[model samples]
Target: MTTTASYEQLKLLKQFIDESKTIIFYGGAGTSTESGIPDYRSKHGVWTAMTRDGFDPVKYANPQFIKKYPEKFFAKNEERDNRPVPEPNATHKILANWEQSGKDVRIITQNVDGLHQKAGHRYVLELHGHHRLWHCMSCQREYLSEEVKRDEDNIPRCFVCEGIVRPNVVYFGENASKDTVGKARRSMKAADLLIIAGTSLTTPLAKRLIYDFEGDKIVVINLNEVNISPLKADLFIQDWVGEVMTTLSEMN
Candidate 1:
C-alpha cells in the first residue's frame, strides 16, 4: 500500500503550489510505474534483470555491449518495443494540467518514454534521451518508431545509407546530453518551487540537482526512500505519485 504524509504536510504542499508561480518537476522511472513501466532499481524493476532474465541492462544495454553483441542488443530493445505501450497516468495528467493552466511548469524527467509529451506537456527536458527515436550512425538520419521496428533482425539500418541505427537512449557509461543538463540546471535555478517525484535520488546527478535547488519550496513525493533527508524537504509526501497527484488535482 502507498503511504501518505500527515495532513499538515499535504496542506503545506497545497499552499506551496498555490503560491509558487514557477514550478520545476524532476521525475524518474517511478513516475511512470502507474503507466505500466517498471522502474530501474525497485524490487521488480529493470535492474532485477540479472536474477530475472539472466542478463543485466548494464551488460546488455551498454555501448560496449552494443559493440560486442549487436544482435543481442537489438533483440533486447525489440523485447522492450514489444511490451505494451503505456499511457500517462494521473501524475502525468496533473502535471500536464498545471502546464495547461498557464503555470510556468517545466519537467525534467529521467524516463526515456515519451509519456510526458503524450500527456500534453510541452516543455519537457528528457535527461535520458528518447526511447522511440533512433538515428543512423553514418548518415545521422532519424527513424521513426515504426520504421525502426520493421527490421526483421531487430537491428535497424538507415534506409538511405544502410548505416546501423541506434536508440537515442543513454546507455551505461554515457552521460546525459550536455544541452539537457544545462537546461535542467537553469530550470531548477529559476523555479520558485521544486517538485521531485518517483525517484530515489540515488544517482549522483539526481542528488546534485536537488541539492542545488534554490527554490523557496521543495516538495518530495515518493513511495520509497528518496535518499534526500526529510529536513531538506519543505513537505515530504510518502505515497504513490498517481495517488498524490490525483488527490492534489481534486483539492484544486
Candidate 2:
C-alpha cells in the first residue's frame, strides 16, 4: 500500500501540492520556533510547573479560577504577556507566499504568537488565540500589547473596574473555539492536500483537527515521531520545518 521508494514519496508530495487548488495547513509550536518563539511544551521550552494556593498553577488561572481570585490569576499569567517577541521565519514566509500564490487556502495553528498573520497570511484559525491582545475581564476591554507597558502595574488591573487583566490565549481548561473548529473542519473537507506540519500533534484540539482531514493526500512533517500514528497519513518526514518548507517551496 506504500510507495515504491522514498523518492516516489517526496515526488508524490510535491505533485499533490502542485495539483491541489485548496490546501490547508495545520501547524503547531514547532511551526514558529524558527522565528525565535519558545514552545512552552517542548523540552527546550521555559514554562512548566509551579503550585500556588495548593492548586496547580495551570489550573488556578483558568476562566473558572479567574472568575474567583482574579488578582492571583493575573499575577500567574503575566509571564505570558511579558514573553519575548518572535518574528516570522522561513517556514512562515514560505507559507505566506503559498497563500499569496493561491495554493495555501488557510492556516489552522495551535500557536498564539500570530506569526502566520505576521508573515502575511490573511486567513488563519488560531485555535489557541493570540498573545497580541491584553484583555480585561472586569471592563471587558482589550488593548494592544504595547499599551500594557505604560500601565503602572505588575498584574495590571482594569482602570475602569479594577478587574484582572490576562493575555487572551486559550488556557488548558477551556474548550477550543467552536468557530475555529467548525471552519477548520470545512477547510479540511475542501482541501485536496492537507499538510500537518511542525506539529507533534500531542496536545489537545490539534489531533482532532488532523482527524478531520479526509483529503486525497495527508502529510505529516515534524522533526520527531508522534504518539498516535496518523490513520490517513500517507507520508511522514522527521525534518525541521524550515528546511522542509524551503525544499517544498522550490518544487513550484
Candidate 3:
C-alpha cells in the first residue's frame, strides 16, 4: 500500500523545511521499522503477534502487574532486553544531519529504542521512556539494562540495597515524565514547522502534544491515513517514512 510521492510534492516538502527556522519531528514506532524494529499496532506488529500468543501486553506492561507479579514482570523485561539492537534508518540519520547542519531541529518521539540518539541527535525527548535505562525502586539508584539483566534471579535486584530493579519506561498505568512532556509541548508550540511521521496518531499523548503545535506548516508522512481532527496536515504523504525522509534529505 506504499505510494510514491510526486516530484512536485517533494519540492513542496523541501520548501517547507528550507523556509522554517525551527522544526520539530514527532515520530512513532513506524519510524524505526526500516531499522528492523516492529511497530505495536500494525497488522504484523508486536501487539498482534503477542495477542496471538495469548500474551496480554496491556495487562502485563503495567505498574500494577509489576507490583503484583515481580517474577513475571522481570521475565517479560528480560525477553525484551535480549532482543538485537536496531540501527538508525534513513529518517533518523536525516534528522540528525539536519540538526548538525544547524537547522534548529528537535525530535519528540514515542520510541524507546534510542535510535535518534544513536544517530547523533542531541535534542530528543522520549515520551515512553527507554528500555536501556533501569533503576532501583528502593534506593532510586540508576543501573544500566545490562547490569540488571546480569542478575541470576527472575526478578532483578539492586546490588546496592537488594531492592527491585525496574526499567525506566512508562507502563500502562503510569504517567509520562512531566519534564519531558513539558519540554515537548514548548518545542511544538514554538516550532515554525512540525513533521508528524511514521505514526497512526492513535495514542492520546501523541495527539495531545501535536494539538499544541502552533506551527504554520504541518507535514504528515505515513502509509496509513491519519485522522487528527481539526489539526490537518498541510501536506499528507502516504508512503514509507524512511523513503520520504531520504528523498527530503537529498533535496537542496
Candidate 4:
C-alpha cells in the first residue's frame, strides 16, 4: 500500500475491479516515472536538456531533419539521453499479473519504456510505441529490444543497412502505428471500467482516449490535477501510481 491508501480505500478499489468484466487501463509517461524513466514533458525531463541545447524537442525529431542530418541528431541524442535502464515498477508488474488472471481487458499505455510488456501483460495496445525496440528506417527491419539495449549509443542503429534506426515510438508529428490505435479504440469501447493511473491527462491522445469510453466508471490516479474539465472521474486519487496499484493487487 502507498502512504496515502487506507483500508477503506483499498476496499473500495477491490470492489471497483470486481464488478467490471471488461477493463482497460490507460496510462501515460507518469506511469513509468516512478521506475526512474523521466517523462519528456515533466519539469525534470529531456525537454529541459533540449532547452539548454537551444532547440525544441519538437524540432529535434523532425522526420525531414532527421533524414537530412542524421548524424547530428543521433549524436545529440547520445549526449542528451542515453540512460534507458529504467525497469518495470511494482505497478507495471501487478497490471501484467492482473491480465494473467484473465481479468485485465487491455493495457493501453502512452509510455515508451516497454515495462508493461516486459512485465508480461499479453494484451497491450501501445499507442505511442516504445523506446526499447528499434527499427531500420530504410529496410524497416525490426530489432529486439535487447539489441537496442546492448548498444551503448543513444540512437541505436541498424547494423545491416547502417541506416538511422528510430525507436518505434511516435514522435511529435509522426503518426502512431495504425494497428495499435485501432486495438486501443476497440478495447476502450468495450470497457466496463477504465482505470487510468500515473498520467496528467495532458498530451495528444492521452485525454482523448477517455472520451471513447461511454461507461461511467472511470478511475484516475495522478500526482497532479489533469488539464481536462470537470469532476467526472468515478474515482480520483492524487497519489503515487506504484503504491496504489500494488495495494490494489494485494487486495485479492
Measured against the true structure, the TM-scores of the candidates, in listed sequence, are 0.92, 0.83, 0.93, 0.85
lDDT on C-alpha atoms for all candidate structures: 0.82, 0.74, 0.87, 0.76
Q: Per-residue CA lDDT of candidate 2, range 48-147, in tens?
A: 4343236574666478787776666666566655667667998888888878877666888988888888899988999888768978877879977666
Q: Which candidate, 1 or 4, would have the higher TM-score against the true structure?
A: 1
Q: Which of the two candidates, 1 or 2, achieves a greater TM-score against the reference? A: 1
RMSD of each: 2.0, 4.5, 1.7, 3.1
Model 4 CA deviation exceeding 4 Å by range:
5-7, 79-84, 145-162
Ranking of models by lDDT: 3, 1, 4, 2
Query: How far out, in Å, is residue 142 in model 4?
Result: 3.7
Q: What is the lDDT of candidate 3?
A: 0.87
Off by over 4 Å in 2: 1-9, 48-57, 64-84, 149-153, 227-230
C-alpha-based local distance difference test score of model 4: 0.76
TM-score-wise, the better of 2 and 4 is 4
* Alpha-carbon runs more than 4 Å astray in model 1: 1-3, 149-151, 229-231
Candidate 3, residues 1-252, lDDT tens digits: the string is 344988788899999999999999999987999988889988888878878889798997887777678887777666765778788998999899989988899999999999999999999999999978898878989998777743566888888888888889987878899999999999999999999998987878988998999989999988888988899889998889988988777777
Per-residue lDDT over 125-144 for candidate 1, one digit per residue giving the tens place of the 0 to 100 score:
99889967888867888887
lDDT winner: 3
